[model samples]
Target: MIPSNKPFFDDTEIEYATASIQSGNIAGDGPFGRKLENKLSDYLECKHALLVNSCTSAIEISLFALGIGPGDEVICPSFGFVSVANAILQCGAKPVFAEIDYETMNLDPAHTEKQITTRTRAIILIHYAGMSCDLVSFSELKEKHGLYLIEDAAQALGSKLQGKALGTFGDSGCFSLHETKNLTCGEGGIFVTNDDNIAQQAEIIREKGTNRSSFLRREVQKYTWVGRGSSYILSDILAAVALAQFEKIEPILSSRTKIAEFYQNAFAPYNYITPPTIPDGCKPNWHLFALRINKLHRDIFLEKLKSKGIGASFHFVPLHSAPYSKTKLKGGNVSLPVTDRVASELIRIPIYPQLSNAEKESVVSSMEEVAEELGLE
Candidate 1:
């Protein structure tokens, strides 16, 4: 059976990782780690880039670095990954869940603005499926309200909008290098920023609240506990693997884009389903290829695809309705019509870089069969 996703790797990754291990420096922030950070910074054209253990860690560290803590509220899409809300909560802040735009499955800028309040310190923009949200609108809101804009760009490593990288638009951008992402190092993440102070604070926070990064540069004679922080750094071995994967990003993105285009063309004639929509001037990495089907048919459609040896699945379960959020977060139980609708109707098909042409055909054919069986549209 085709799996929902798979990490694409080869001998190059193994060689790099082996070399890192043989070098006797498997610890965090080592040579390979520095190399990966530098590469990411150059690619994104950001002033600073720091490697962390996970995107969740990157978000939490960024929050702390930006001074978002107790009594502060962060506005985010309720239809996104739980990490966004969890990270805000970890920093002693409240998560004010907002709505999402059905077309892109991203936060609705207008609804997000409505969620803002005096206590709101930050707006976390998640680039859903590597498709950008309305950055212009969100940026305007940020300027108007004097709030911080943090990008949860976990799936947007190669995505760009209006000729600029997606992650660099915000004050702090966090990316995931999980096995399922286009680029992988088993499990790692990156934190990037253009602000000098945020970069310094992020380094300190990532190093467990110490000035070790400064000492490493010989700028400081000794490093000690200076502030609140955590051990959020990534290992050199993983960084080595990540570096290898990073070098192959263009090909990986190219492969995924082809698959996404194929799916879009295959399903365009089917009135029963709606394929992902890309806004003008937005260049996506095609991290995920999702279709919006009838809410009543989504579950059975996934089951049918699985039975046909095709890996298809539903996406997020809107955070506002989650048991934890409903009970723990204030205003979390509030109504978000768009978020609810999209969560129920959305279905993600296999679109990884390693998916073969035959596998892609099988997925499309199986979906067609399922739609026919269900008498869809």
Candidate 2:
């Protein structure tokens, strides 16, 4: 059966991991971890990059570093991964759900600006499906309100706009290196920022509220408890694997881009489905190719793909409508019509760099047959 997601890896991953094991430093934040951190900083062209256990931890520490708490609220899209909003709740802050641009599946700047209130301390914009969001408008809104911007760039490691990286546009950017993501270390992530002060605070919070990072730098004679924090560091073993993947980022991104373009062109003739849209000046990493099918036929399309031994699936349930959000999220219930509609109609076919061309053709041909059988013409 063709899987919906599969991570790409090479022999280099095993080689580096073996080296890390023989080095006697399997703990977190060791030599390999430091090396990976520096590579990420240079790749993203950001001033600081901290390798963490997961994207969730990266975002949580980012919010904490910004001094967000209790009375403050963070606005994010309801159409994204739950972790985007969960990070805010973990900081004792509110998560205000915003609507999305149905075309790009990213946060809609107009709808987002409307969610802002006096309690809003930050706006977390997720680059849905690896496509850069409208950073121009969001930057304007951020400046107008004087609020912090955090980018959930988990799926957009190499995505950029006008030559600037997606994660660099915000105050703090979070990236995921999960097994299913474009790059992988089994499970890992990184937090990035340009501000030195925020970077220092992030290092402290990631180290469990201690000044250990400073001590390691020999800037301080001794390290002690500093503030609220957690052990968010990635294991050196995982960092070693991540380093190997980072070295081949270009090939991985290029392959995925080719697959997405293939699907886009193949599905364009079908009137019942719509391919993903990449806005002008945005270079996507092609993390996911989420096709919006006829709302009435979306469920059947998934089942048909599965019956044919292909793994096609839908993405997140709108967070606003989730039971947990109903009770936990402040400002009561919200009605994001666009978000709800897109969530129901969207379906992702098997997309990975390793998918063979014949396998890709099989996926598209299967969909075409299914579409005809369902009278979707």
Candidate 3:
């Protein structure tokens, strides 16, 4: 049976973790964590990178650093994880749900304009399935509206757009290194930005609002209270694990892309399904190989795939459908028709870097069989 996703880690990570433990410095921002942050900066072309315990923490801390609080409105797509909205709520800010573009599954600049008000302070753009949103086009809207852009690049560690990394597009961007993400450290995330002041503030916020990180950097001898903050940092052991995975990032990316291409090629012939597409200016990391099946038969299709041991599944249920968003935010308008439709029909095939060529072929064949059985082909 093909699994949905798996980290492509090997012996390199084991040695790194073991050595870090042996050294007795199994704390935050240790050798491996510092090195990992430096390497991520070089890779993402950002001036500062702060490792955290999760992408949610990264975005939350970013909001805290930006001084966002109650009464502030942050425009974000409603079709993604509830965590996006949750982060804003945690900051005591309102998350104004912006519609998404069906073709790219990213925030729709046109719709985003309709939702903005004087309270709007930021625009959070998610790179769905590791595909970069049209940040350049957002450049105009962003500048005109004076709205800060925050890229939710959790699934887009290796993806780029116009030669720049996805997460580096806005004032600050967040990436997840969760167990499910391409670069896994079991569960971790990072925040990257070019602004020195924001970086310093973020460091303070991530360390329980203290000067510990600065002290660890040897910028000072002792650390103490400096600002408002919380503990949002990644442990050294997790950094060691991520460093080993980072070493093989190239191979993992290549393999995932290959599998994505195979799924696209195999499913291209079907008239009833639509495969994922990459806009000309964007390059996707192919974190998940998703397609649209006939919504009417979507459940049966999921059942068939699972029965065949294919491990196929679906992504986020439309945030509007959730109880909180439905009651508090959706306003009972049921306005996001496309988001509902897409959520119903979407299917995620197995996309781990370790997925064998034969397993990929099997998934393709089984998918075609289910489609044919339901007269979808």
Best by TM-score: 1
Which regions in candidate 3 have their CA more than 4 angstroms from the true location?
329-334
TM-score of 2: 0.98
Q: How far off is residue 134 in model 3, in Å?
A: 1.2
RMSD of each: 0.9, 1.0, 1.2
Q: Candidate 3's residue-wise lDDT over 1-377, tens digit each? A: 78888878788899999999999988888999999999999998999998999999999988999999998999888789777889999999988877888888888889889988999999999999998787877878889999888889998999999888889989889999988898898899999999999899999999999999889878999999999998899999989998898888888889888888888888888898888879677777888887887788888989999999988898778776778776777452348877777788889889988788889889988988887787776
Clashes of each: 0, 0, 0
Which sequence of candidate numbers ranks them by TM-score, best first?
A: 1, 2, 3
The estimated TM-scores of all candidates read 0.99, 0.98, 0.98
Q: Write the per-residue lDDT of candidate 2 for residues 53-125, one digit (tens) a residue.
A: 9999999999999999998989999999989888888888989989999899899999999889999999999
Q: lDDT (CA) for every model shown?
A: 0.92, 0.91, 0.87
**lDDT winner between candidates 2 and 3:** 2
Worst 10 residues of 1 by lDDT: 325-334
Worst 10 residues of 2 by lDDT: 324-333
